[model samples]
Target: MQPVVHIGAGAPGARIRWGPSPRAFGSGLALFALLAVGCSEPVPPTVTEPKPPGLESEPRWLTFKCVKPGCDETLDVTIRQVGARKLAIKRVVLSEPDRTEYSIESELSAPAIVNEQFKVSVRYRPIGGPVKGDVKLLVTYTDASPEEGEGRIPPGEVSVPLLRRLVGEPVLVASPARLVFGAVSPGESRSLPLTVSNAGSGNSSLVISAVDSDEPTIGAQALPALGLAPGSSTEVQMGYAPQAAAYSEARLLVRSAGDMVAPVEVLAVGTSLPDPTVAALPAEGLDFGRVEKGTQKRASIEVVNRGGAPLELESVRVVGNANLAATLPNEATSLTLAPLESVEVMVWLSSETSGDIDAYVELTTNDPSARLFSVPVVGMVTAPHAVAPGSIDFGKVPKGWVLTRPITVQNEGWGELEVKGLTLVLGSSDLFTLRSLPSLPLSLERHQKLGLEVEFRAEAMGPFQATLSVETNDPGGRFLEVPIRATGSTCAEGCPLENAVPSCVGNECSIASCESGWFDTDGEPENGCECSEIGNDPGSSCQEAHYLGEFPDDGTSQTFRGILPWKNDVDTVTFFAKDAFNWGADRYDVRISLASADPSIRLCVYWHETGNHLSECYLENENCPESRSFQRTGTGGGDDADYVVKIYREPGAAPTCKPYTLSVSNG
Candidate 1:
């Protein structure tokens, strides 16, 4: 046991057992207590933040390699934190800007790497220079810890320089690779030439193939099978003949051996030898005998190919009847048939009938023209047959024209109806023609219709009556006779008229007047007074003779000779009652003119009362002052002398320029 030592209490600072000095032993005990405190005290351990593994602080080793395009390469990079801990960095920048360029995908990498493993990798893209791309990598590593040595980690960089090369692009171009020949007909042969040209800087091969128009027997020829040199060309020739009208469009497929195969079109045309001709075939058509009601009968037609080449089939298109069908029965090229080969075509008849049936078979083949041969198919239907709206009615058609009547022939019958001949009869001359319309060979199917347009033109307006006859395969309506009435015309010009003007030259008179100066209406005779015979100027209301620029007949169709006896100086006057410019014709009419281009002269006459006030027998004179206004007085439109005008060559005493009070009448 140890004793406490304190000076103030019982001991100075230490105490020990009595006897020999225990100071040394006491001090040793105190030392032992201190050591125990130091060893046994619970102290919390501190966790210090680890210092990130730092990159080797040294000059960076950067290498450049120029590849394609062979541009000189250099680098430029500024080391900002060569000595600083946080921003410490070493770089190599491109010095020659023309040879190298640097681009970072993000702005955060502009200054420094995000971590030690982050780096920018560069490679040559060969686009006229050394191209640079960026690469950022993340790696795991560790530094020396207090208790543990450094562990192995992936060696990487935030961004690292990587010298790489991009492949160089080659020059390429497209060339024609395929050839096609359009459509070719039968009996006609044509040839097409194919030329191949190399448009690329490099050479290429062409392997052509036919696509659509493949005629096995026909052969083709092409030049230069190996290929075409750069900027060179080759040609191919294809020939074939079509027995019929056909278009041969062949597709040519070409392969360039290495690059590509292009397709092109080659079109060809072929002509045919007219379709099969059956000159000796039955013209009466096929005869299907004893067809019971409600049963179908089929007839087959045998045709022989008489042309030079094999029979090339165009088509076996059926016309008319839905119940009746016609077919060649096989699906093969028509040319497979040799010359003089006979083929059978079947015509099916499925309409209701009790007697014989007729079916027309049309055969078209390698010939340019094909003839139509008919085979009669018999069929009987148990149900009844009828026709709706089958009659054609022509309403009031004018004469001298062809009347066209279009009618819809509806099949209201359970059995198909066969219509044979439809005709317009009763005085059907060359002027009247009956068109049977588009011929529908077989049945009038239920709800089926046939269009028939019939024309009747030769109509004359006098109650024309005639009958239209129609014949069909229907027993009841085999001969349909219907009445067709029309009105005919007798007069070509208009209707007849009464009191037409009759001309008479023996007395030189027409109708109510006589040329001997006598009028039937008036009884008396005069020198020149068949009043109505002379025409007056309509423009001028004056009663005067007119000489048109050309001659005009006053009473007859014949032209009257020029006004003789009156010389150029004499005035043969024509009066225009209306003003030419203003064209104003007053009811009183005032303007007057001379038909003759001469001066005005009045051949006057005297009048005095003898029997009545003016006697025709007593007033006979060749000259006098009695005259009417003859010439225009001024621009005001009246003659200077209101009634009298002196003769043109008066010489001695002139006739007075005054209006005489004597009256004159027509010529």
Candidate 2:
């Protein structure tokens, strides 16, 4: 057996000695040796130092390529545990002195072993211009001890700072950001230049995929895939072609390849020319109708510009008739009308000859289609002819009774008739006298008639005859002679009633007829039909109104005669409405005029159904008559509407028996 040598624990250079044989020492020696080794100051353990925790990132600096403002770019930073110990990441932080443009998206959660890799995602969004920031990783070494259960022991964390710079910027810019093409006519095309450039701070080139327009009418010139170096620009044409006149706009979008930068927007604007047109009001033409000869009639012709552009009127003239003339409203020969504007041309027709007139007002304007437009001027002039009955007979009039007969002379021709003279023929009966003769040299228009009344008084029973002469300016009938005749009869009793004619019935005097505005109210013959219109006033209220019968809707004026005996007397008269064929009883206008020789008569009108006063009391005078007019619409059904007119004397006026005439007409 080989003997074993044991070295005793010593400070330095300890001696080695041979121990007894294994047979002789046995287990005791072995135990002693083990105790010797255990009892001696335990050799200081050969301690092995643990490797320090270390982190190494792939990219030391982060660089982000942002296309434009408010654009984000992400970059992944791979962190690896290079040391022998495990490492834990406590936190990740993004820091910047100015604006915060960087953020950590994802980070490692568990502790990393040796050679283990983890990633921290960082996102960068540039506000504007050049921007930079830092990313810090807080990490510490993890403990090597085992955990109580299946989990690892919580490591005492000590954060280690890691920083990286982030840079983000824009690369493309547009020059002359807006393009305007002004006043492009319809079916016309116009274009303006737009510039696109690369504005990157670095040496990178900018690639534009396309330049497009949003509007169909507005477009940009086609460009191949273009690449612009930094600080270099390229020009493209922005075009506008309008099919019709209108305002249009569009955006010229410049898109970069790969969306490295935001799409550059260039606003484009344009306008199209407007068209001008001329039109005439009353497109048919003007007609003077039947105008009186030797007189002038005036009318108007309106020239309008119906389009969106200004219209130029060259000249307005009248032709085809020497007497027809046309003048602009301002007497100017030429004028300009704005869009949707109009100008009136005054036209006058005068002639001494009597005939149908055919003329035209010619208008010259800048309207391409209607350069020469004509408005017809048509009218007729005629001479007046006197028309009268050859003779008028009064039949038989009672003795001591007076009566008047009408001698009507009308102008049946189409011109003014001047009555030069009206006289009784020489050597005519003295019993016949002309009464209510229209003043000499009276004028009458076409279809107008004048009444020359001949009054006959029966002083004694006889036959009266006279010849009335009427001279006028009628070319055919210059002078007209109308015979007036009346027979007077003897009555047993003379008619003594004022304003009453006597009728002898079996040798008794009775009332035959009373004068206008007078009535025979009392039956007694002694009074002799003595009741004037004032004696039986119509009424003072609508309920007691006296119906004056329905008036026609032909616009013919009718006169009603009445006498006011005293002051404070009111006469209410009602008339049923006639259908004007305008929505039932809706009358266009109802006019009532009051006139009297005494100038003290006043008039008032009211709508009877509603009892609403239409007109306050108005006093009449020689120059200006009192009148009231109203339009009754939606009032009644057809002829069922009734209107009341009240007549009275002016306040504080003296009582008199003067008669008044109320003229009423509706259209």
Candidate 3:
């Protein structure tokens, strides 16, 4: 008998009865008979249902619509796994009829496992009109291996419907596919009319959406989004503005609401003229080679017009170095140049002196691109010469004292200028002498300068005037006379350092002897002697300000130096002009600079008569490393004018003295 057990009972413990058997009867009955025996129920065999094919897709249909312009139509289909079995997507393709307009955008050549998802992109083109088909996916999968019968499943085709709408099929036609605007000036414009018509169904709405030109210079536009019924038409005007001289080609893109058909393209052409272009034959410059002094040379420049329109020549003149002259034909004063027309203008060079002839042939024309043209003309006028200053002044000299001054003599002509001799022609020859005359036959090249020195020894106190002549190879003349004037003085007994008194010096504008080892270098007596030595008290108040006197000449600038003595100390330098009316409304620039390790020094300028502050500058603290500069560029005054520059230190600055410079320059 088989063993009996409580089966199918959901309980932890149960009673079981065992039937006597041959093997059980023979077991050590004596020792095992006393053990307790129990019986339990057995569990039945579990059965599982087979999984169906696993391929699935979300939204199993794909639809494409070609409505928007300049863009393709596409849709996505998702293939997902649904069951507890492995599957593979082998290949995906579109139906035969849809292959012309649709194609799969994803590759499915490799095997895909279970629970995997795939997104397939379907692209559709509207060129093949409206179409409908199915997206067929070929899938290869496996059956359950653990359960009975497991093998490679057969490949099956899963179809998903694909719908496409070639949104609108409006027949858009643009008449005369090309346009030409014959010729237009740079600033002129021309316009032409274009017609767009739709010969489709009345239910369709056609938008004359866009009209664009390839060239920005060519302007075009159409009635946008023009709603038209079948057999209807509208006109668009296109304009062209030629900004430069060129043959411009452009294209017009006429688009409809949909990419229903290819865009109607219109070819456009325009021409803008640079009427006349002046081309010089040499293309660079005209050289009259070598010309002789007091003679003439001739050359010509051909003016050619390589353009589509007439070039009008207004005038031709000579500019630059005046040694050369340019002459145009009488007919060229005012002439027109037809397309590819050319003319020749005669240019002449005549020189009265010896030098290089550098001039330009300036031609004026009506061409838009080029209005004025300059052709260089160069030639060498052979001669040799020297130039001397008009006059020289020894100023004032002391009695029985010898003095000397020098003037520059420049070679103003080409080649070598031969110096023959220098002689005293007039005045007291006994008092004047040539320190060292130029060596005989001294050759001076072009642009070379030499200094000629003259000496004067005064034997008595009186006024003296003399003329010294310079002999050179210049053809203009053989002798160039330079005048010299001076006065001699002797220091009187008890001579004091006063403007009217005798402050004896070797020569005027030289350092003069003053009491206390003081010397005057600027020839100004209004300051009681202005000195450049350190620690000299030039006065620091408006009343005791140093008088700088008048500027020596128009557009002359003077620079002077002074010192700041103590904190809160203001140093004043006053300037006066003798002929302020000569400058008219012209402005002057007055700059004052103060240099110091301490940055708190300030410079201020004011009108002496009015005491009005003009400008001031100063550094804030010691951290700043720059110095302060005060400037005034505009001032008005009477004939006898007075202006003052003041230098002061800020309140918190150190009391140490510092040196500063004041400069007055032309504005």
Candidate 2 on 1-667: residue-level lDDT in tens?
4465443321122354566665666666556667879567654444668644566555544555564456767878776665445555544454342446556654555443433767777676755433222334334445444444444434443222223222333477877887767556789898777787777654355566777788889986666354665566777776789898765768878887776688888877665637556666687788888776788888898876655567888888988888788998778978888765678889987767776678889989887778898888888887788999989887666666667777788988766789998888897788888888777788998778998788777777777788999999997777799888877765553345667776677655677887776656445443455657743457677666666676556675677777766457788777765655654345545667777887777876655432222333222221223443334443443443457677888888875667777778766
Better of 1 and 2 by lDDT: 2
Backbone clashes in each candidate structure, one number apiece?
Answer: 102, 2, 3
What are the per-residue Cα lDDT tens digits for candidate 1 across 1-667? 4453332221112334444246776677667677777578643444667644444311132334554343545433222221123332233233333443333232234334434333333333334322233321222222222243335232322223333333332222323333333333565555666565545442222333333345442435544444443344556566666544432334434334444444444433232333433321344555555444656777776655544356655556455445566767574323345544556766676754433333455555545454343344433343424454434444443345355555555555545566665666757533345565775455665567666655566445545444556566654567656555444333222211122222333422234333432222222121122322222212111233232221111111112122122122222322112222224421222222222232333343222212112111232223343333322212433211112212232333332222112121111
* Error in Å for residue 433 of model 3: 4.6
How does residue 231 of candidate 2 score in lDDT? 63
Question: What lDDT does the true structure give each of the candidates?
Answer: 0.39, 0.67, 0.63
Cα TM-score per model: 0.18, 0.29, 0.31
Q: Write the per-residue lDDT of candidate 3 for residues 1-667, one digit (tens) a residue.
A: 6675553322223356787664665464533444523333443434667655666555556655554333477788777766555666655665574365566765445454545777777776644222223444333444423354455454454566665433345678887687777567787889888888766642344667788888987756447443654456778888888888775668998877667656889987766755555667788889876666878777889986656677788898889766666656764457887755568888877676667767888889877777998888887887776788888886656566576888777888776778887778855467887775666777787888777778888677778888888888887788888988777765442223443334445333323445452434344442334443464556676566676666522566777776554445667666754334444464444444555554666665554432322233221212211446554444454323356666677777665434566676543
How would the candidate models be sorted by TM-score, starting from the highest?
Answer: 3, 2, 1
Off by over 4 Å in 2: 1-367, 378-380, 492-509, 512-667
Model 3, residue 144: C-alpha shift (Å): 96
In candidate 1, what residue range of length 10 has the lowest lDDT sum?
A: 550-559
